[model samples]
Target chain A: MQKTALTRRTLLLPAVVILLGLSIFPLLFSLALSFGDWGLGRGIPYEWRGLSNYAALLADGRYRNAAFNTVLYVVVTVSIQYVLGLALAWGLFLRPPGGRIFRVLFIFPMMLAPVAVGYMWRLMFQSRIGAANFFLAALGFEPVRWLSARWFAMSVVMMAEIWQWTPFMFLFLYAALMNVPTSPIDAALVDGASRFQVFRHIVLPMLMPISIAVIMLRAVEAVKILDTVYVITHGGPGNTTESLTMYGYNVGLQYFNLGYAAAIAYTLLLVVVAIAIPVIIFFKKEVSYT
Target chain B: MIRLNSVQRWSLFVALVLWAIIVIFPLYWMVTTTFKLRADIYAGPALIPWVDFVPTLEHWARVVARYQQVTRAMANSAVAGLASAAAATFIGGMAGYGLTRFQYKLGFLRNRDIAFWILSNRVLPPIVLVLPIFIMFRTAGLVDSRAGLAIVYTMFNLPIAAWLMLEYFKQIPIDLDESAKVDGATYMQILTRIALPLARPGIIATFLVCLMFAWNEFIYALILTFSRAQTLPLVVAGQATQHGPQWWDIAVMATITIAPLLLVTILLGNRLIAGLTAGWGQ
Candidate 1:
């Protein structure tokens, strides 16, 4: 019979190969491209421009707007999603009538295409001929142009994100809630502590690790947001809701400026990595706790 | 334990139901709007379907007939998602087997490092590498093709699959594989016939989870394809702005995209939950 070591190596190599090919190769390729000035049209050729691309993004109004929008959207949406998600998790744990079916219902949005979700909202948010405005008029408020105005359009985009991702937070927080030791909660209850006190003093503290994990994870993901916003407003009104990825797409694919686009994409990666490192550390601690 | 009073319990129930309805209304709105006519969907503050208007299948039929890419894109997404997930699961299962069943030492890095290295791939966002991958695909003539997209998704999903399967493999007792080996079964045979079969539920969960991700993917498909290899999500995104999106039609398209996920949710509820907590929920 053949040795197990050989079998293990053979078995493991494909995954290693595919992972490296996908990640490291593109990482290096993008890293190299980021340092050059390359474009297709107007007879522009690949020329060395060390740090120029990164430096240029500093003063670009559009890039700054995208950066600001990305930060604003992530902060607003992640905070709303976390609060709602935790409350929903607590609600689910309470097991109200018909709660089981709702668990299934809640996750459907998170699973559907973000693009599809965006399209549904886009239809709903249509200015004159849409259901959202129809309700606004019914409520005695004037019909507002949701996607035509920068603030409203961005709000609409964030709404789509919050609507879709809150379920994700719910599922994770709910799972963590299940894992929390019941001993502390039971002791708090037997001590005649109030419901809010029991939760705040014991349960919430117990859930802190998971809360941090979930928040950090979702925060990292929020920074990478693209598909939904792309469909909802296409970074529109005046680049108000534009994200780093959207801008990169426009520059790289639409504008055919590969080098600068690569730089933009690299910046996105760096920003995400900065946030993700702490998350990685948290999970590592979680591993030891478990 | 303190008993919740009727008033408290009832209020809690109401609050829970309200929360769930708020969560579920968009999907309900999508379905109801699909059945409503263009004028009705456009004109309405009506949230309820039966009370709002009579439903019709005209838009549903038109979604198929009008957008020729509707069916094609769905099929493309299926192929890409299913194929990549299957590949990822198979390869990842083997890798998981390697990680769980055997030990290896490499220079300066151990097996744990390799596993985490794979895990690290999952953390990077799709758009970061889309440009470089697009350039590579362009040079290799692989862009806008199903195989190329599947390959991308395979890499996209393989890490999670491996991580998940590694956990699954640990749960399964190693004695069975050891016994099978004692009976002269080869490593491949034991893996195929023993470990894999025992972990079938986890594998299925992993496959469905990966399939959900690849199928729902938008940006990669957007950048990598023009019209030929567009996935359903890409198609929906593209057609949403075309000719002033017919809400009814968009709803129909949206429904088609959501239906499979709903089925997966219903059929594999526990597995789906497991996959979500398995980390990298999308």
Candidate 2:
């Protein structure tokens, strides 16, 4: 009994310490930094300012634009990726003779590094000699100047994101589809249910767990997107794609406004948590079964 | 036993085939473009690289010529990635083991709290940590160092590491641990000899997940490191220099940066899928 107690204590103690060191410390440090005059060039001398950083952000147009960009990014990317991913998974789930091969081909984009994808797509989107423009002219239409225009720049960034991550969401949904019991689909078919009806009534309901998880995971990631924007536009075409992560990076690292940057970072944190908590709650309920 | 009507089957087949082409085309373009000379690339947007053009090794040669920085960056990335994987696996394994093996009395630190806290940490946009970390690392003289990058990556990776390992450990029956204990095995002995072996697949999955996170990481690498410790992405991004962008050199650099990641994606394709599934569904 004494040995059992010692063993238990040994196991529990290290786990607690690890969590405190890794999780708790970072959160506390960030909370403190958000309230101070932290900047890049000059070191932050331990001075406290209450809510001033937050106040400034609330009154800043750039912050508002960054927030809007983040929301637009998360909402558009998640919705498009989810809808497209589900469609692909549904098409792939049939286990056709070449299904394995098709699945492999589908996930090809997810394999490349995001930076590489950004570069490749950036090359393809170039106005004068890009493949996208080259193809457009071949088809006898004026080229769409993918990166030079604001709306088109944002759209191109979104395209790069969807290109890379749709595979991820597809993979999740495919696995979920594989695990879903087939009896319901069979029953629906026997009752003369159309394919769409079968999907709506049976397959989608079962795939909801996986769909929710994928959306939540991908949404949080999309909200803080940086790589493609950084590599492609550098948040350019006049800050159309200046996401909060990019915004915080510009402020803290480039502009050297640590206090304002920390506040921007914190607001981003709140938005991420606000979106994630409900999905996590949903995930817990879903995962309880398997 | 044909289940679907012919039209339905063929429609699905056609759709899959088309999208597969669409999905795979860009990747194919990247690989093929690496072979084409400057003139050939501009000649037309033909998918076939077998056209009338002399394939040159110049691009590959240029990438190889800068081998020192490439090797250094690769080393920095590998050290950070593998070390963080090791550390996260150890820490996460311990926490996972404790939560699975013992029922602690702290209501605030219950299983749900542990899982939720970890998940929330991951969901926190890493931008939130940048200011504080810059300040903290600047003070500690750890900025622009691989160790600092590793610590930051660990913070980013630990939450998912813990969550995955927790689910993985829970799936293992406790009776195995009990049986090992009954055979007079120490906790360390059981962890090393029994649980570790049994959890090999999960460990591999966790390691790959950690590696990909570390390797493909750009934001932290950008903020943390200057020229001294630049990784592959930084190198590729540097192609867009002050004297206007060199398209050929940028393409060559991109090919280098993407090669390893693509290799991993193909080689560990199934494993990467499995790891990603575990991260998402569990």
Candidate 3:
């Protein structure tokens, strides 16, 4: 028994050490740094600011704009992806012709790097010689500038996000749907329940757990939207498409305002934790009830 | 189960086909653009090879001409991804096994809290840690090194690896461990000789997922590495020049960037799905 206890500690030590050294240390350092003023490019000594950075962030218009954009982007993209993914997964559950081929193909977009996906969509949406405009021209319509306008650029970024991640939702939910027992559905159908009624009553309630889990996962990731926006718009049209992480990057890396950037980072962390807690609690309750 | 009527089935087929086109068209364009002449690419959306425009190897030739840089980036990505995945799998597999077989109490933190704490590392945004890590790496003179990048990737991938392996390990009967214990097998011996081998598929799935994340990771690679240790995503992103993005060149590089994982997805789609959805039901 003593030997077993020793071996267990030995097994877990490496992960524990690495997490504390690499992850927790940096997080704590950043948290402390958020309260001080230091700029790498400005060549200034560290000075304690006592929440001034946070105060500044509260009043910063660009920061507020970025916060708003991040919320809008996460809400729009995740909701659309969830709805479309559920529909597609349900269709596949019906076993359409070429279902296997479609499954593989649908996953292809997700396999590519987000940076590559961004560039691929950038090529498609290029104004002068791109496919989107070319098709518009072919149909005798005026070509629209895709990346120059605020809403258009935001839509393009969101579309790229949805295209890449909807497959993720579909893949998980499809697997869940496959595992769902058929006996209940059959029993309900035999009891004279209509298809829609059976679906709403039986299938959806069965799907609730996985659905919430997938959405929560997607929402958490969507809140950190950076790579696509970085490649696609660079937060262009006057920072209209800038996500919170993008703004943090600009503040920390570009301007070298490490203190303020850390504050922004902590704010993002708070946002994520806030979003995660309620969903997780609801998930726990649903799982227990089921 | 409620069966689909013929009309419903036909409409579903058409819908799937339409969505398939939407999904495939962008990828089709990416590949086709690699073979098109600049004139043809800018002239219009010439989608077909033989019908709309003549295909050429000029872009491939250009990418090949910069073979040194491209290949170096590819090698860096492969090394970092594989090393981190392997390390994370080994360590996280052990951690997972320990969590399952042994009870750990650290203050108010039990096994479940420990597991969630590890998993929460993933939930933290990379941007938040990028600067401090950058500072630390700079101080240690590890910036722009593949090893440094691998270390960071390992930290991030550990949560995923540990969580997946924990779920996978849970599926195995604890009675096996107990029986092995009665046979005088130490915990290490049981983990290595019995549990790990039994959980081989899960380990591979975990490794593949970690590799995919490391391979496609960009933000850290963007800030940490400049040129020497730059990964494939950076190479793809660097295709933008002062003049403009070279469409054909970007297409070729992006294709190379995306190909390996695409191959992995095609080959191990089901296992990958299983790994990703491991604990969803719970």
Candidate 4:
């Protein structure tokens, strides 16, 4: 028993120590920093601000806009990704001709670095000499500025995000679809059920658990959307497309407002926790039931 | 699997083809743009390599010429990504084996709680940790060092590694451990010899996933490293200059940045997909 205990400790110790030092320690430090004022760029020493940074965050319009934009981006991108991803996954699940090649090709976007994807999309949407505008002109429509406007810029960023991540959803859902038992569906089909009806009644419920899991995964990651936005828009012609992380980045790194940045970071943390906890609990319950 | 009628089959094919076009176009554009001259790149929709514009190796040649920064960055990324991934996989694999094969109670925390706690670390945005980590790294004088970047990446990748390895280890029969123990093999021996070997594919998948993230990681590389340990993503991002982004140069650099992993994905695409979705399936 003692030997087993010793072995367990030995096995677990490294991971625990690393997480403590790198993950938990930094979070604690950031939490403390959030309540202080440390503008390194301004040559100001650290000073206890006592919630002033949080107060500032609450009243900051740009911060609010960023928060809204982030939520909007997450919702829009994840939703679109889910729909498109499910459709593609269903298509692949059907075993179409050349499906193997299509499956490999589909995952290429997801494999590229988000920054590269951002740059690729940025080039495609460049105002004057862009492929988007060129195509528009060819279609006998006037070239519309893609990046300069608010919604358009947000849409472009979200488009890139969806294009990149839908493959992730497809992979997950397709994998789940493959795992789904076919007997019930076969029985349903023999009972003269329509394909749509059989999918809705039989397959959808079976896919529910994995579906929730995938969506939760994607949604949580979407909250950290920064690299693509940073490369493509840099928070845009205005701060319209700035995400929570981007705002935190600006405050922390670019502006050197460490305390305020920490506050923003903490706020983002709260948002992520809020989004994650319920789904986690629900998943736990689902697992228990199964 | 649903049997598709001819109409359904054709529609699915067309849809897949259309989506495939959307998926492949950006990559196509990136690769094609790499061969185009500066004038051709900015000269609206010079897509077809030879027909639309005369192809040139100028950008690739220039990038090859500037191999000092590019190669160093690539080397940094490779070292950091591989180091962190290897470290995370080993450590996380151990933790995973421990959780699966042992029953533990840390006060109110059980194995499940501990596992969830580790996995919850994934939900923490890098933005929140960046400042504190920056300070920590600066204080330790690890700023702009490959070791520092690797250490951080190891930590961030640990949750996924541990979680995925947990799932993988679970799939391995615990009876193997029991039988090995009865044969007078130590727990360490059982793990190293039996479990690790059995879980080799999972470990490889975990390592690859960790490597992918660490390799392509941008924000931490942006903040922590200045010059000495700047990764490829940082190098690619640095292409944006005072005189507008050097699109041709960026295309070249971006291609180089993404090419290695692109090859990995093509080769191990199915393995990656399976490994990625493995944990999520209860």
Task: Tell me the native contact fraction for each prediction.
Answer: 0.61, 0.58, 0.70, 0.67
State candidate 3's DockQ: 0.64
Which digits, one per residue and each the tens of the lDDT, describe model 1 over residues A88-137? Answer: 88877766667777778777778888988887778778886666888889
State the lDDT at A4 in candidate 1. Answer: 64
Clashes of each: 0, 1, 0, 0
Off by over 4 Å in 4: A41-43, A286-290, B241-243
Model 3 TM-score is: 0.96
Clash pairs, model 3 backbone: none
Q: After superposition, how far is residue A251 of candidate 4 from its true place, in Å?
A: 1.0
Can you write out model 4's per-residue Cα lDDT over B210-270, one digit (the tens) per residue? 9999988999999999899999888877674222457778878888989988999899887
After superposition, candidate 1 runs with Cα above 4 Å error = A41-45, A288-290, B1-3, B175-186, B278-282
Recovered native contacts, candidate 1? 0.61
Per-residue lDDT over A107-225 for candidate 2, one digit per residue giving the tens place of the 0 to 100 score = 87876678888877787787865778888899998978788787888888888889899998888899888777778788888888887888888889877777877788888788888
* Alpha-carbon shift of residue A10 in model 3 (angstroms): 1.2
lDDT of 2 by residue, B181-259 (tens): 8999887898889877888889888877877778888887888888767887877766653322567666776777777
Quality of candidate 2 docking, DockQ? 0.55
Place model 1 in a CAPRI quality band. medium
Query: Where does the lowest 10-residue lDDT sum fall in candidate 1 chain A?
Result: A281-290
Off by over 4 Å in 3: A279-290, B241-243
**Considering only the true interface residues, what is the Cα RMSD of candidate 1 after superposition?**
3.1
